[model samples]
Target chain A: MSVSHPPGVHEPGILVLEVPGDLAAIEGVVDHVVEHCAPARLDRRRLLFNFRVGLTEAISNAILYGNAGDPDRRVLLELRAVPGEVRVRVSDQGGGFDPESVPDPRLPENLTLPDGRGVFLMRELMDEVRFNRAGNTVTLILREPGPAGAKIPEAVISTLEDFRTQLGLTLVAWTLAGERRVRVFPGGKVGGADAPEDPRPGSDAHGIAGTRRFRVPVGAGLAVEVEVAGHAAESPVARVLAAAVERSASLAREANRNRAALEAALEANRHIRLDMARERLSREMELAHDLQMKLLPPIPRLARVDAAARVVPAKSVGGDFYQVIQLSGGRVGVMIGDVSGHGFPAALIMALVMSAAAIYAEQGAAPAKVLEYVDRAIGDELESTEMYLSLCYCMLSPGFPDIAYANAGHPHAFVIGAGGEHRRLPATDPPMGIGAAPYGQSRIRWKPGEDLLLLFTDGLSDTLARTRRMSGEQQVLKTVEENRQRPSGEILGRLFELCDRATPSIPSDDRTAIVLRTR
Target chain B: MSFNMRRFGEVTLIEVAGQLIVGNRQELKRMILAEVEAGTRRFVVDFALTGYIDSSGLGILVSLSKKIREVGGRLRLASLNEDLRTLFELTKLDTLFEICSSREEALAE
Candidate 1:
């Protein structure tokens, strides 16, 4: 449908554009308004173009950043058309910002930062502005016809003059369309309002990082407030502009929230579709995880051997894994892997690596050959998919006392004897994903009753403390040496405990570890 | 060392809190300067309350101390927190000023 403007509109044309508070809808509104106005009004010298850009900005900002993409907010837009002017008012349903306290985005260093430019841009675009007390409603005025002149209302002028005695120096400027210029003139400071404090030279007031007020004269005898307060300009002006801005924001938010509630209510029946999608994904992940987990043998029910394993995926699904398999030939195969990063993709890659390792192991492949196959398969897949995984695999012979293993970017495995002698089985190759590194194996014969073998992902040793000084493999060895007297499971647990104690609050990568000991 | 305060008359303690970060630091500096110009320099700053501080806060604090000292008075800080006190010790301001356990102790010193 075409936009309809009523008759009797004067020199400046005013059109109101309304859109939902959703980011997509607000953006559509911006495009629609810009498309309608930019071309047609090129010839019009004095036109009043107003619609709720500021309000839309506030509501959409709340939708995108504040609520973090929650679809429950409703926004309303009200457009008022006057002679040579258009005012767009947007109100949101969400809680509003405190106008006096927004962080300054225009500070010298903040000019290039990614945040805090929205309000400043909004203020620059509108000719005259008003903000509500709660900082929700914002009224933005645009003069399509360009500014007519300093038309500050006599009442406001007089009020300002009454308060001018309080300010030592008041500089006012007209912030016209497409400009950021403030000039010093012959006029003295107007007196009226109570002065908070006179900013001294070399003080924050004198710097380019604080607030300064100015006046803009729009067409048809309307003079709007302009602030050039250095860095503080955005917040206090946003406060004054909040009256108009907040209303628009409130209206927009209310509309969006109501829309969301309706959609959510409808979702009671509609959730079948979402559930269907979720179930499909869950099915794939469950199958993948099950298959991968099966490759890991359940605890060998041997009374003599002390063995345990743990894996915590960083997501609903994860790439970091630990597995122990009871081979058909009466041997045990143990492996640990870390996919390049945490996510479903990584989990998927890890699953592939696990399957390849299992297939190789089932064929009676040696520790080195199994790793070579897994690495080749994983490296090929990573190359094809542009992703990578780190893997470590081991084969334990009942006849041979030492554990045999190969590391592909995985940390070294630790071995602790019953009497506290500790040693690390070091791998001789780079990570599997590097493509060119050939997997190599190392074997150590176990001493009679060498009771504990620890296999772990890097998560245990890769902590903030070890991040700079040494590699996780080195830390693992150090920790193992320190805790050699502990049981295999206890050693792994204590290693993680030590790292956790060092950097308690740091968000760590996923952690996984497996312990196997000859009885 | 990071934050210092002194009493001019009685009961007017000027305490500085947090890092007076760059760009916005002039405000804090001016506040102190204004009070100094107004001749109300008597201050008992509890630095123990400050968790962190930066160069600007340090510059302002030192400048205020110098300003007050030139005016025949001083600024004293009480109950310095561990980190700030460590910073003071590192900066060697621990020797330039009196160290006290509490605001009352600083006042007495």
Candidate 2:
């Protein structure tokens, strides 16, 4: 059905929300209604809660059963408010059904079914509920505390009426105008100037003889004053009325303070929500970091090679990985690689490369062929992420005097000879995913017992430069040359010590290092 | 890092200083992208004073280089200190763009 807006009817508090028929949109609608009630003078806790639940049920029914989850269909929620009452109408664009035909959901047989209960709950909870003639629209009306638009609360009026009946008070009323006093009770005015301008709770003579008067401040210039025509100022009935006026004023002051406190608490809740989101992000980063650390292979004690590797993650996860695989031919495969980028996305790509590299190296594939296999495996992933991985792999056989290696654009792979002479491995091919050119293998001389091989990622270079103010590659060469005769484990441990010394107070980028000493 | 741009003949020289990482890298991307969109494409990025750069920063430079190249323009890198050179080499990014030893070398070409 086509919707229409009748002009010239200016509602005091009107809200209209048009939402697609989706259950996921329920929370947003509920929050909107709850917030709308605060300014509509339905801020009392009980009234707000009842209105929220009632509205939720009404909207959910309209969206679920009435609209049947159709995206093309719409649910209309309109809230029209007077001073003390809110009339809500939720209508759905669907074929109508008879309200009388709906089975009673509270009966024993139908109580277990979820589909038939929302309308029953909405009717029972709200002050008044009715379905339109088409049965596709639900109207819910709720009246908050106090009579419809009554200035003084219903309780205050009833209390004063009790006083009037017990001792026949002639006038009892309130006015918010601070500087001037106008009589506004008993449906008319009977003024005798203002109440004595005293902010205390006591009585004095009204304009009429034998009548008593009392007024008390109700916060921000509003006051409640009572006048009894037949009672004297100090009489028992006048004293009772005086106590009741004081009680009403005190309640008003408490209510104002509570409203302020509620506002403060709401602001605090908003900040807490923001802090929670930040904390959750940090926690996720840490989890990704730990996952990357766990992916590094533990160094195994082979017959002739002592191997060690270390990866230090930054405050956020970084994309660096290393693996030491003992192959089938008494030959060992050692690899160090870095994926471009940081954080979870980079770390995830690093993990994929690590697993693919391990599987290829385990099959005793040549270093060049291993890189080719890995490149083909993650080719699409690298292209999609706009990133690549640089790798340096070496296959060392204990009996052979040469190490067969492949360089895939990794710059920090080093080979130290027996006399402490260092050889910098050059890039044989571009980094993975950058060039389709094939990987190339080369051979470098090494002393089985006295020489060591060292490989590193760029974070090591950045770390040394940031902390030691020294050349990154040079510092690493000096460390390796000095400890050439040491076992691979000790050299790797010492390198980690240096890294800790460099960044003592803060976590640095992911720094990976591998030292291989073949005896 | 902050960028200071100047014109040298047909080329736009963007001199960058300070550390380049994820947070401030977008500013560099915005400045270069704005220029590239305005049809000024012959560019040289001088990183002599740049102390550090992270993966995100590197990613932007790589994407920017490709963008400039796709527009039928050439982008060059000049005056990279040893540290940045090592970074480029490690990631094998040194092959992606033309590198010159100094800004004077870049201008001469």
Candidate 3:
């Protein structure tokens, strides 16, 4: 079949080949592409290298997988060439498999699998890889890249070459391409990128002691040594030559120093930006911390239930917040939460959750519904910030024997019995902002005058003690077990006291806890 | 902080010096990302000359590793000092990267 041409093919157009679905066709395609690509150019050489491998893999898959080893099948491979880039498309006639269903090759179990690594390699090697909805056609893009010091101009070096030609100099030596040292005569020729071609005449090992050479600092880790014949360092012509070379080198050195100084200034500016961001965050956190502290509802005076909560941040602000809201129909709602991170952002989130939860929980909303509302409200922010919060909110009403609660990844919620037997209020959903799974509500048996409900944040349980060890959740449970018979607020107070005594060092985090009991 | 780069076959060996802290994390990130954009697929970050690293530096490495992996490149680390070694272990990031004790091991085929 004849090669086809597509619209927008620039002069010296793209390459199209219709090759039979045979493995033998690979060598022919590689050779044809190499011939058409400009291998002499430095940037294009890099592009060619990447294209060779990516195209090989893509065409191999198209032939083997798409054609299913049928020699009669034809694979359509199209290569579109642009300035400093190449786009290739490979299509075949076959049913497609879901790319998503492909197992991760990095997993230990899949590591031994040989057949599935082709697509992974292609995606990794190429700059861009995309597939059509049908999944049979794959398009890949590759770009050219110049080396680190490619920005230095050729005009700057031509002046030295002109001076050398005028003086009948021996050779000019300089570092080129940020990789290799090059020596060139007054002879006019551009050095290739790969390596210095046509080495300058009489360029053998010459020590700098004997040669009347002028050392020129080219900066960016480069230096040029200009040596002349038939001239002493003190000669009038040689003196003039050395002055010119030194002046140029000094100018280049100044330029190089300015560049380094500019980079350093940029670095300093970045640090200043970072410091400013941090300072602004801390300042805002202090304000939000104060506001959130004020937003905390004082323990409600209820005839049927008694509740008390306290939150203390290790820094000026923290992620821990609590809500004690009086709901309609003689019901009482208690909530405690810990955002994933601390300081300004977490404090802001806590403040938002505090205000939103207060409004929703006081409207007699169900525990699950209140959590769902909060999740929806904060889901975008949580997703953007890549953080999540743990929450345990419960509703207790008069004559209702069970307390309905929704636990969103909160670990430290419990109901302690009069005999010091405590039961964990199980987590009913993945943490808010983690999963789309609906908030689940579960009820536990609640008894008046016989049971106490307790909730605490991880900062309390995770506090480091004198042992340089974490004061674990087990410690909190033990503390509550020791003081299960005490009133709700007194239990909280003693818990704080125990935390203070266990202070092996400074508390590195915020601590918040809530306790509730029926009168 | 400063970086020096050398090439061996498909891998670009980077020699990092000074402390990799918040002060220079962005510069480190830019250099690495520039290479990735330039089609360098394999990198070995040699930390033998490095003195210290904080959480910000660690965070930058993680981000760089993720971006490189997303583009089908691999980044290996070599010769971490005691402080860096402990920081990686403490943060459980030792599991996420391929860290070697010597340049030979990092460049192994």
> Which 10 consecutive positions of candidate 3 chain B have the poorest summed lDDT?
B51-60
**Which structure among the candidates has the greatest lDDT?**
2
**CA-based DockQ, model 1:** 0.03
What are the chain B TM-scores of all models? 0.73, 0.93, 0.94
User: What Cα-based lDDT does every candidate model obtain?
Assistant: 0.53, 0.69, 0.67
Would you list the clashing residue pairs of candidate 2? none
**Candidate 2 structure quality by residue, lDDT tens digits, A1-519:** 111122354444666555434454454455556556644576364354446556767776776678876644567776777666778878777776687787775455643332454555465546567676567777887754222333343345556767777766675554433233444454422222332233433333332243456554443324556666776657787777767766875786578568756754664554455345434545666787798888777987788888888887766667898888999978999999997665566777888888888999999999999988888888887775556779889999878988999989998998888888899888888988786547898988877887788999888877777666568888888888888778787888778788778777555457889998887
* Model 1 CAPRI quality: incorrect
TM-score of chain A of each: 0.43, 0.48, 0.53
Give the poorly placed runs of model 2, Cα more than 4 Å off: A1-271, B1-109
Q: What clash pairs does model 3 have?
A: A124-B72, A465-A504, A466-A504
Clash totals in order: 91, 0, 3
Q: Candidate 1 versus the native: TM-score?
A: 0.38
